[model samples]
Target: MSPTGERVAMATDELQATLPPAVTVYERSVYSDGDSTFALVNDADGKRRLYVAGPAIADFDGGTVQGDGQVFPLTYGNAMALAEVFPWLEPTTAGRQSAFGFGDRIGLATPGHVRAVRDSDLVPVFAQQSIREMDRTGRSPEDVLATAIFGVFQEGYEGGFVADADHLMAREDVERTAGVGFTMFTCDPSEHVVADADSMSEEKVEAAFAQIEDSEAILDRYAGETFEAKTDGFTWSDSFSEIELKRAAVKYYEAIEFAEELYGWVAQAVDGDFDFEVSVDETETPTTHLEHALIASELDRRGVEVTSLAPRFVGSLEKGIDYIGDLNEFEADLKGHVAIAETYGPYRLSLHSGSDKFSIYPFFEEYASDYQHVKTAGTSYLEAIRVVAENDPDLYREIHAFALERFDEDKATYHVNTDLSNVPDIDDLTDDEFPKILDQDDGRQLLHITYGSVLSATDENGEFRFKDDLLGTLREYEDDHYAFLEEHLGHHVDLLTGEIED
Candidate 1:
């Protein structure tokens, strides 16, 4: 046998001899970097640890194992070390494909994401979070990436995965997540998107437009010029008149400039190529075709290659619920956006706040095809709560009651219309009926947007009030947790990968 095989054999023998009797090795996880062998093992109590053997064991991070070889606890440093040997642990670009990003606010949802994507056509972005989520949950970029690495390893998923620095609004956000090896930089330029431009008076629009550098050159390029675009089954044309050009420029010029600068920062921070997703989906006004064309063309002119762009589609795509709007209008609007994408760079059109927008997935598959990316952040946390609701009803009840009190304050940042009265009172629901609340709009949004408070809330003595119980219960009932995630996230993957109707 070859020397590498010999090393793997020797490591396997050592792992079998040294590991505690109670620890069951994840058989498929055994891998070798030609010098050392690594595997994931689950203890009798269900805790996971890494088993490494051979001379290279000293180079990897983690504590020593019992009988032979070294065992590393799943940690940020160890995850980094392991990635050096198995490069799949590191994030990579998903390119222009039908991809889905599963955001794990609490960092334990990747295993289920892996299972859901294993047999699907879409690429899986396992480590995805925003700066707001990090601040609220007190989780760093490293924590997000590290937890995903460990979960990916535990499940023996080696098909490859992408990591997204989702909703990055500033240079600092890009730098922080880039330092931790995130490969997808989703630049959120909504702050610079002038939403009032839609209703601004001609004088106001002109003022804002004049403030932009090289306004005349921009106007000369776009004003009175017709641009044609097409997608699979749709063709469209858009032109901006003098006043319309000024409005479009005022609405998105700053945002385009911000993305250009942020793109440079991303290029500087990331050592190699990274997926760049420009997001203006958080704005109040919908992004018209003319606006999208301007943003895409300007970014292209600036030499910024966007892997995907998330426009603020017409209608309401609120958090944690099915879409609420006229589907026909949304489809028409989506066709225009897809046409714009095809005309420019043929990039993916991402859907932000797309946790449970079930009614619209078919439209995306039909219009965007492979040029699409759906991001779902907070839904996994909701599924985790579902596990808690199913297993620990008392804990779920306590969390529900607290969520009610915190909903008004926490709902400030999220774009949700959850009327408190719509949610059934905790006392009115029996223990067996507790899990049913997750299916309701108000109850789901109430629990969905209040995750940060639920995870970080403390008692009067300054100790944690719900964090420990919430996590501990989830950990104890991990199988159920993965099951729920698999069911919910799997449904998403299935819907997005269905056959496109003719």
Candidate 2:
């Protein structure tokens, strides 16, 4: 207090003076790569809580900060844009201090959300009410935050703040989240940890386990010898050792065991009470049958409540499958899996990665009533980008830069070596040519241009441009997109209650 001579004081209890209230924070497990953890923080008594996770303490500790304790160095343009978007984010140059009060969890998508959570006001009703608002009115993040705050201060929602772990891959993820006070958790059973294709068979399942064991042996050898030799002074041997390869055996064997153990632990922590859900990719190769069994068995074993069984559809069948025979077979396979989930009873089948298809609404509606929950994340975010783009082309450029940077970072994090040649030559195309490229039905072209049909330039980037130009260039199309979403997805206010009429 003596720096400016406005006040000169001495504090006997520095910690008490500097620290914020001891608010209990809740985190939900999402995807992580061991670098950061994501969670949704809600003030127990406040109205707003944020859902996102960021880096571990180690990454934050001793980290230098830029202006106002901003830990990471951001470009001037990006910083300015953020400040424009969130004025509260602008702070004095001490660099933002690390809010890594809790240790880090792994995952990618959590960090952005964590940043949002940390910087936002806590609202108690955020969890219980905002989701409904999101479902019905299709509220933006800002809108949700505002609603949550109003509810909390005005005694709106009373069930405490709720946050969902959208999709998690590991048991430790769940454990870490639970420790952080998250009550909702959803496990993703789609990732195949097996190394070889031959492990799909019963005999090969055991062989796969053996192969994993051998692989671990090889990895251990490298960890002990090669890695240590390379680093000399630094060793990640313990980290590698903690990675239980046997637990990563094919979905048929080890996945179920891992799920059982996770559910059991979660149950024990909550006094024999547990609420668990599972998610699968509808387009996963070899299907997710073994993973499904793992989920069902684990749920039964622990008697944990199964909230929702969400299946994420990846690429379109028309693109993923080559021939008519393959497409028919793929559809049959998907139907069979859905049937199995329905047969299990007490499970609600959900669909993920849903959007931009004007035709899939019927298919979604056919099962919508039968399922407990349905979600589409990227679609909404994409729409928001589009909205921003329509209002300001400069914002569109900034967002594009941000997205491309994020994509590059994602590739590096996954250790992927991408071939630029593999990417279709679209640089030569003009604005007029872009429409023709999208209209083509060739799977190869789609694969080359789109990222395995997981993301599309038209839907992602073009839509961004469309959104930027929405209010100005094509107000009609803007209204169309919004109206279409509202009509098909049902009003975003009460997603669970509202049904879109056919």
Candidate 3:
């Protein structure tokens, strides 16, 4: 019995005499609400008891006692109370070991993927097979496939994969990608082709203007007829004499109209929901710059808010010192973009291809404090492979080969060339060649090294070179990546949202 008057034990000599020495017994006072109503006697005799206070205290009452001394109704709460009173009464620790292994060790990238995996009840093999099938068919719906692929993680996942239309030069492509459910897009006005008055002679300028005027005139002439035909629901059973000319005029007008419509549509689509980015190519021709300004003005006139404006000021130059020139140029262009973003209200100025340029962090911090977003992608992924490769050469080689094959395929599809003169040639080279290659040019070196590292980390078959090592390496990389961002780029990224720490 406890010092508080709770019964602690009951004498059972006869049961103890026949039972093994390991067997023991005890008694405990149990309560209900505020009433001390029963005494719990536990023994090898299987809880034989005596009733002392309730109405049926004299009878066993089917092994249940009703009096104050009787123990009645072994409810779950009572069972817990009994266990608390006597620790040995509970199940053994050995019996409580987890039935299934791998508890709480796994982590996920987002929450949405977790729900998808849980709801679908998919295992890793199933998820991998689904991704494989998706890759083969290229028909996976954006949301569904993103969820399935990312759902393999056990924690820190939110459903869906996010991809940005990195640089889109045409309104049609923007609308097309958006229709396919791409939420992030970049519209680059610097790619617009514009007439260059400075580069061309006066006669050439006049001729170009004349051609434009003639085209507009031809369009105006048949514009009324085409509108009338369309409004009247006219159907053509055979080719008409002026059909081609009229069609061209209609197409030209529609293209212009599409541009205006697209500005409004993208603005509405991105408002308060997703990031709509615009990039200005500082290296573009003067005419293209002017055209982009016109587009921005049109967007402003249409009441469409610009969210972010990125300027590509740096190029693949040969010298590290040349980056200083690039920086100066970037600063000049950044001012214009900043002015635009500030005037538009809530818009930010961003930098693109922000990789391997760790030296530019201070510059970004100084100028882009008010900006809303900053993005860096390929750098961290490259660093991830590098870390894994340091520990395992074979795995590194596999990943490297895979990345190279994938990149080669991408290059082929996109018609990208390495500009052999810009890269090092090691054929029949001396020992001095390696150092020369490393010291050649910072910009080119960064590009080559990043690409080479990525290629080296992948396998020949275009698979992730270290598929088996992905989880551990990814975790380590994610940790280091976040730390890097916090230490170096955190000022630009939003600490709360983790989106460019704006």
Candidate 4:
């Protein structure tokens, strides 16, 4: 053993001898909670647990604790704050690469996510959820982190993971997510991206540019500025002309300003390394080459250190579906984006609506060296519904019917195209046949957007309709759910890693 290991082992031996039989000294350290020198240890149940050894369990109140397991005052809600007990859990400056945010919107898929991530050489973001999703499902950020950590604990996954506060907009949101110990922040500027920017007239563009407070400074820095490839990782075109420069600045200045404000807030409020990203993918128009340059340059000028950026591309990246645009056109746009990354950011090109776009995986595999990240949330939800359909077809039928009704209401906040006429009449299908809904396009989109309604919907009595049945059914078949994700998301990771044969 190393010197530190030897020292820790000796201390653990000494402490384990004094501890009771119900609890064991699983870890050894000199860390103290309040009045007592305590260490995180395992219970007799084989759980990686830490409890107050002596009388301190009842009195301690630092970080939040799960009140059900009242053996000791756990700091990290259920366990002691891992960041305090373990050095690896603490946030640190990222290396050249960062993990893709595996957003577990349903809160039960992390065990499966960890399973997929363990086999690959990729960093896994285990705790990733957005503010809107939290509101829709009535989940707090603390609950999201707790569920993820519990899954990690269940699998005994010691490999480090990142907790991402995805698509954060306001200072209050940052404060709440940081309080729950999120290590990464993706600030979205979708609200600021003006509509139809790619088709804006030159007169309108010039007028918008002329009105910015720092218009002269931003213009002078890039209007006639030139750049060529400096190194290998990120490449620039032969040149960036004045026209391109003006176009980018005109299209993205307002969004840049909003991003800067939010990014600055997160950078200041966060206790450690503020892993920051800029997301502009929710707009109406596709982001162009010059627009990417403009956004990066503006952020850099404001001293915002961006770790990643998501630009809206030409295609429609819908939830729970494959890529919809022309593949060749997408390839051309992707080439320019990679070049922009080479010139502007050695940062990850974040993909926002990246759930089931299978056609694009090969391209990602080919450009794996470009330092990219793809985020997924809805596909996992669909996977959970798949579990319900397989295990309890009655509940599946009820939820599907409810989802069809809730589609219009819930889809207001999302961007997807689904014609109800295209959806099959669920009444015509037998219980055994209900599972086929998942294989169809309209059914996938309908169920995808209406997840919030189906999960949170209630009958006239105000009690949960399908929520209880869904969670219970999932609990009964939890192993099956994990297996499905292993085969499903594992395929996605494999495809991106070039592990899957063409």
Candidate 5:
């Protein structure tokens, strides 16, 4: 922020005098050069234009420049770039508060999400996608944020939205996503979570801990030590056996180290303010009550300030389905988890596989004031598939067949239990009845997990088999798809906000 010149700041009268007589100045920002400012003005005909008010004016000359300082296009694609120049246009973290992350897997679900979110108190994370998904869909984080910017402009939504670099797992990906203008990073540490660490024997846990170079350092810090942490209403004071301490450390120490590395990198890598969401919800076993406190307390001790934490709750929160576990048990576990979070920091209690888990929304509503973040990505994609099934039978049938063919392979990474036999055979149904497959839980789960394979599937000829056709068909029936998303996603929002009718 060095001074480019000795030019004095303009007064309001001087600024008005410099503008066109008939134009209205909406915004003005000091250019990278301190002597000049750029104004976002509306012309007499109501078209938005960028007006440069400066003495140094050789570069612009009413044409686009190719170098560092260029005239931005009026296209929606430039919204993100414009936001960079004007900080007001950029969205920041919504803080440790109640928020909903509506991830649009196809990049077409934002407008519907916007419609659903505009009426509620919950903040909208309209541009939410994981690094895994970006790889799956051949998209970069920039594409995800750009698409959301356009969606916001289309619907005249200026309330602002989150550009979440969701489920990020590596250090290099952290630099890449932050450079692409994401305001939130969900660091997923599931890769380092040992399978069934809660059930490991003391010998096994010690052996696992023996692999760490400084295992003794961790043991000296927490082993045989009583942890006494409290909030106004809750307190957790417990001592762990050396084995129990090593077990928690073994399960999460590597993950926490990775998170620490990524957090420090991203905090300095990006230009603006951002938030961190730590996710340990990808492990095999359910996250134990003590495990939740262990991770959070250790994170605090390591100087990592978490913005949100996703626990592996007691349930099968499978894809495109309701919570498949005891609600009472979930509520009990959730209350304890929330208490742990409160005792440490009032960070968000984030739900990871939170799409269409209708039965659990009541819990979110119950703890609305306590701050919760529920993430949903595949449900919108599911609804879009529903649209395709109803609009174009042939394409839907082709995808159905393709999904079944790729189900087992694609489902390897996800936590779903869709028995292929449970899905009704398409051959047994008429074209008119095939779309109803979306209603069946098994069928929805089958299609849900196979999206990556289906999207990237190509034939022997080395060309896209169904990707182009699917997008084209979806585009043709975009309105139907949007309406469908609104009804489906709106109900989800309603369940969380208590706006649902009988």
Candidate 6:
């Protein structure tokens, strides 16, 4: 029941005076919900807790009451309860806007992400994590989503955000994130995408196509058919021959079928509306024009409402670095992909591994400005590590050296091409120069893919080797961390929104 009163809230300074001596209240976080005033506070121990003050203290359950109200630990349950009081605390959909997924591996980066996104027109998916990331960081889907909610609360950001269950490959993955209230589900069907179809002979392609369910129906529908689409500034037209149709079918039939299945599972898992994104960008081969059109067509035909689709563009979109390929070719390829999205479903064209690709931002904005979603994961973490290198050189040295040792083993899951020999020896550098390694491509990627090892590393006693120190440093110097992310990620938003200076 909503409290009936003139909604009362204590001033930040007043609230801080009433709380414990060491407890500091977040100024922005102080707000009135019903008759009770709620704020997120950090104690001297660096633990964040929820502080509620008002006569309706009993209505706000949990925690010990000090002067006027209770101080509750920022647990998942508390966050959920707070979200009930304020609907804005929950994640929402980005809809048809150009969204950006800022994947926070450590969960402390969303406030910085929020600061960057708030100044731009793009929608923000603040809570995004893959099953692989969850496994590596030992974070539950609940952990990821809750941390994002907490961060959003601490920053007092009322702007809507999307919670993405990113790169989900199985029904369980979708169910898990959906159960935790994710608003978007990205279906990754790369494993099912047959890359060999691109190089197969006509006979081999035909044989492979015969194995597809409803192969005759697919052939009758798309074979020898002319497809055309009009994009923002370009027209795309393509006619598929029987051989080409078979090749496309053999390549993406399974992936499309899997996407359809995943879509159904997502719909069933969620109680209400949820956005769905199909991602085939992680495969070995780039998605061709025909393949993209065919995949979109098939998913649409299967009644899957794809909100966005990440087609593998014609370039090397490697992790934690700039785009690697010819600009002209990429632009030309992107035009067709954008056209396919417009023609089939008008869904956003998502770019996975999208961060730090400063060179391609202009092209994306030019062609798919109104229908694009740029996702960035490791770059934010890299920015945090930069904070460490600048503040605690010894810790940065330890992490960099540990990353070098774990690079080969951890690199198995990623598609990076960083040569360790190219990385500068950190020992030779002065303490002040430690942050420069984050600037070089090889050095950036060397630390990017090995985040799991670095974060999860434990000592002989099973205590965290670097996680505590890393987190503590970031929290203690959050202003600096937020500034770095704001400037760095803000540049990305600026470029994508055409806010860049000449």
- Please report the candidate that would top lDDT against the real structure: 6
- Give the best candidate by TM-score: 6
Candidate ordering by TM-score (highest first): 6, 1, 4, 5, 3, 2
Evaluate all candidate structures by whole-model CA lDDT and list the values in order.
0.85, 0.34, 0.36, 0.72, 0.75, 0.87
Clashing pairs in 5: none
TM-score per prediction, in order, is 0.94, 0.44, 0.44, 0.84, 0.82, 0.96
Cα error, residue 357 of model 5, in Å, equals 0.7
C-alpha positional error of residue 265 in candidate 3 after TM-score superposition, expressed in Å: 4.6
In the range 374-480, model 5's lDDT, one tens digit per residue, is: 89998888888888899889999999998988888888888887888888889999989987799888999988998888788789998888778877776677678
CA displacement after TM-score superposition, residue 455 of candidate 2 (Å)? 18
Tell me, what's the RMSD of every candidate?
Answer: 2.8, 18.7, 21.2, 5.5, 7.6, 2.2
Better of 3 and 6 by TM-score: 6
Q: Write the per-residue lDDT of candidate 6 for residues 1-502, one digit (tens) a residue.
A: 1222222244888888887788888887887855688888887688777888775455455678665778887677777877877788788998778899899999789889988988778988999999999999989999899889988877777778999999999899999999988999999988898988889988899889888878999978987887888866788888888888888888888989899999999999999888999999987788888888888888878899999999989879999999999999998999899888988998999999998999989988888889999999999999999999999988998898899899999999988778988888987899999888999999999999999999999999999999999999998898899999999999888889899842
**318-417: candidate 4 lDDT, tens digit per residue:** 8888899999998777767767765676777778888877798787666544567788888888889999988898889888878877878888887888
Off by more than 4 A, model 5: 1-77, 81-89, 224-238
**What would the per-residue lDDT of candidate 1 be over residues 318-389, giving only the tens digit for each residue?**
999999999999999998999999889989999998888888998888788679999998889999999899
Worst 10 residues of 4 by lDDT: 1-10
- Runs with alpha carbons beyond 4 Å of true place in candidate 3: 1-165, 168-183, 188-202, 209-261, 264-275, 282-293, 312-326, 344-346, 356-361, 398-502
The TM-score between candidate 2 and the true structure equals 0.44
Off by over 4 Å in 2: 1-162, 169-182, 189-192, 195-206, 209-249, 269-274, 280-304, 311-331, 405-502
Q: What tens digits encode model 2's per-residue C-alpha lDDT throughout 118-236?
A: 32222111221112223323333333333322222222112233334445565555565454334445565444433343235555544555654345543443232211111112222
